[model samples]
Target chain A: MDGTRDIEALIEMMARLPGLGPRSARRAVLQMIRKRGQLLAPLAEQMSKVAATARECLRCGNVCTSDLCEICLSDKRATGEICVVQDVGDLWAMERGGAFAGRYHVLGGTLSALDDIGPEDLRIPQLVTRVREEGVSEVILALNATVDGQTTAHYIADQLEGQVRLTSLAQGVPIGGELDYLDDGTISAALRARKSI
Target chain B: MDGTRDIEALIEMMARLPGLGPRSARRAVLQMIRKRGQLLAPLAEQMSKVAATARECLRCGNVCTSDLCEICLSDKRATGEICVVQDVGDLWAMERGGAFAGRYHVLGGTLSALDDIGPEDLRIPQLVTRVREEGVSEVILALNATVDGQTTAHYIADQLEGQVRLTSLAQGVPIGGELDYLDDGTISAALRARKSI
Candidate 1:
């Protein structure tokens, strides 16, 4: 690992990913070698491009390649509803289902008192501001079912009570099920059966 | 969605991510708008830097910031054992465990007759060459438990059955469990109990 600190560094970075590690990183590097032309080159190109240009949506906490995320700028998305999630991955998961018609508000993460995470730590204040400024009629809490996540949902609910229609994803999502792990059917079911918190 | 071609182009690109759709891409774009400094700017900067330098390892099939991967160049890793895997993600998973003190060979993909994928379609030929030249003593087939994976492993066994010790991860892994999903303990357990193929 001495000569290729660059590769090691890449692996190290990859290891920090949600489900990767050093050994897996090494194997991945090797596979990238063989498919350099097809997969590796394109992935690297995109990764770099994203790394250089990718940014969180200033309005909603989503990742984008631009200054303003498209949903915030689009006139058509003014449906007066905001679906809040814990991470971009959850937002992506919701998108893959293609069931929701309104805009989104990514929380970046949930409130965790143990972690010293609070509303400010997430995007709660920003969400509150958006509800008032953007004329949102509803706020959908699409966060995970984790303890911290529920705490966050409750906090947001308390902050937005009587200001808008407040709801949470229904019972389709199993306990401890991250949005990332839920199937399209489950997400759709949860969204359909959404209940007021 | 139509203002800046470059930005729209970026959303289009992002839409192609594994889980992201056009709608999510749009929402993602909007979020980037609000947090240009805190998230978007930094992500873009990092993407640019990675894009400029990211390359695949010449010796192994891993993605690297240079031609040679750190593991391939490491003297300590030259333990004559080559753990073979089917994807870069799997490699990264193994790496996260922080075990295994050998080199690696990324097959890029498994032999899939249904998809018309064969040994030549993957990095099998290169793997054979590596074994011959690298004086590899053991070959751990860390491929998935799928039929295609087993087929590929068998094919490789035929090619180098007598040349090196052949082993495979034990059958504890779920049938369709991608290495990406397995926790560190399961992966380590599989590695430790790997049986001779």
Candidate 2:
């Protein structure tokens, strides 16, 4: 109502953001308005700039402003190790930790037969090509601990079985989390992935 | 740490987002890269368009693209009711619900002695002027439930005590929430605001 149409439009757009809804979107918009100069303006400017320049690395399937992504072009990054992940969110998680000096291979999505998903739908073929072309020696599957995620990981591992070394993230207690509160799947995974201490 | 300086810069900027840290920022970047045409391009276009046009509503503190926000120019929205909030987020939240049929007044921030914020620092003066100039009969305080928020609300109430009818959101359980899981403050507020059966 009133002259809130623009604000409303903003809220609608923000609602589409991950982990936000109409309520949170509205709150975020209001905060942006209140801090027009400090927070909102800078954010808007940066967002626009990135929007204009953003493009994918044609070879590595990584985000970049140019034809080649940072990972693909970086000569220092370990060429023999390729960390595979289910989604971009997972890739980002890896980057935040500042670990894994190797380059990444993002499998856009996991194999979901129920949803009619296949290897072609994901970047499975591209991943295989990258392995051979880049002379990868190790392939680390960092998929989520979900059913579909594990299934996809197994499928990838089977495909690359004789070609390279396959490994996964260590399962057990999360660094800042408790074990008693762990779900059935986590508990089972932890038990199965028990390492030699 | 890679060749895509622009992408790195974008990721760094994105990491500063409210809920997104470095990790989430990375995943988001990767996703945008993989879905270059469907999700990334359109999002980038919209971001640029909004960045070019976005501005604060001179009258009501809402965000808009024009000199006069759509709400302030609409003749049908002169409902004499003004919803006053501590931030633009609250205003946007209200707009998202698409319920309230009145205008909004954004008070940049709440009065906070700890942070050295005072009435002059906020838009209290503008609010007073708007009340008198806009023929407003009622003012709704939609500030947060925090100590600073309440303090600011009381201050506003005292300022316009004799001039206009003032009300606030009813305190109670939120929709689709378990009362037992609510904090003590919420429970107390709900108890104190109990209505006659």
Candidate 3:
């Protein structure tokens, strides 16, 4: 083997990450080597620690070190409103807004016809169980604007209709979105959903 | 600690890498946790192994597990020609082209007047010593097309004037680069360096 085999292997593994390609992986590996004490050691340690303990929260499908997520255990979050999202990343995005004080249900992914993924493939059944078991009053579907995402939201909406107050995020112009840059569908939706100021 | 604290820490660390930001890092961490046995465990194990053994080559400053890098140790590489680059990443790029059979000398960084970086800050002195001692005949400066990079290359050339045959990469229009989008300076340079191809 080459003398740099191990280092090359490390770089290859890092390149397989979602956002990093070979070029950035090489830079990252070099940077890690440069700051071994401050970044590499701690990162390596944390990765191992997290790899050992991290798992899907049994209650909400959020990543956690235990069976139940922090939001599920914390009584402070509003139990009446459950924001359902397609992925944990979406759940985190909502948390970053700092305005959503309610708990979440991560669906892992949306329904994909091409991939043959359906309700059973995601955490839809678990979400329905949570809605009934937790006395949830509002089931807000915060899925993406994608076709598959809308289909999944509609399916979930149908599941919980008449049982509780069901709602989905409004389809309209986003905050600070420019009208000139918006697509025809978005512009039409925004016009249709126009509100009095 | 919260149940998701460890997972969050892992995401934070992943985000600090070159390509990944907060959102992508969260997604990458979640994927890693999901594929722990297949990807995460192997990656962590490989990183730890490399972190323990990785070091810079004494001769060329290339990352390696031994005193000399693989390129330095290889008998097939030309000893008379040394491709000088500002960073190890640049050296790797040249290698990816599969044309350069010469050894390399990594300067680590360029001479930056604003950053107070001078020849002494880089591996310039060691390079001079290597040229004198290693029976080198050519030094090809493959520095970036940046102000600091040009200044560093000029400084190194001045230091080794008449001692060796110094050359640099051609600066002109990139292959497949649209002429319409080309900057004025680049267009002028390409005109000036017009070839018979």
Candidate with top TM-score is 3
Better of 2 and 3 by lDDT: 3
Error of 1 at B153 (Å): 13
The digit string of per-residue lDDT tens for model 2 on A1-197 reads 32345455666765665555676566655555545566556655655555567765677666667888677778888668999987656776788798888988878788998999999988898989988888899999999888999999999998898999999998887888788788877788888988898
Cα-based lDDT at residue A150, candidate 1: 85
Candidate 2 CAPRI level: acceptable
Q: Write down the worst ten-residue block by lDDT for model 2 chain A.
A: A1-10
Candidate 3, residues B44-128, lDDT tens digits: the string is: 8777777787788899998888889889989889559999999888888999998788899999999987888888879899999
Q: What is the lDDT of candidate 1?
A: 0.73
**Best-matching candidate per lDDT:** 3
Winner by DockQ between candidate 2 and candidate 1: 2
C-alpha positional error of residue B152 in candidate 2 after TM-score superposition, expressed in Å: 2.7
DockQ of each: 0.11, 0.28, 0.65
> Against the true structure, candidate 2 has what lDDT?
0.75
Candidate 2 regions exceeding 4 Å error are A1-7, A35-53, A65-70, A73-81, A88-104, A127-138, A161-197, B1-3, B65-68, B79-81, B92-103, B131-146, B161-197
Estimate the TM-score of every prediction: 0.53, 0.75, 0.93
Per prediction, the TM-score for chain B is 0.82, 0.89, 0.94
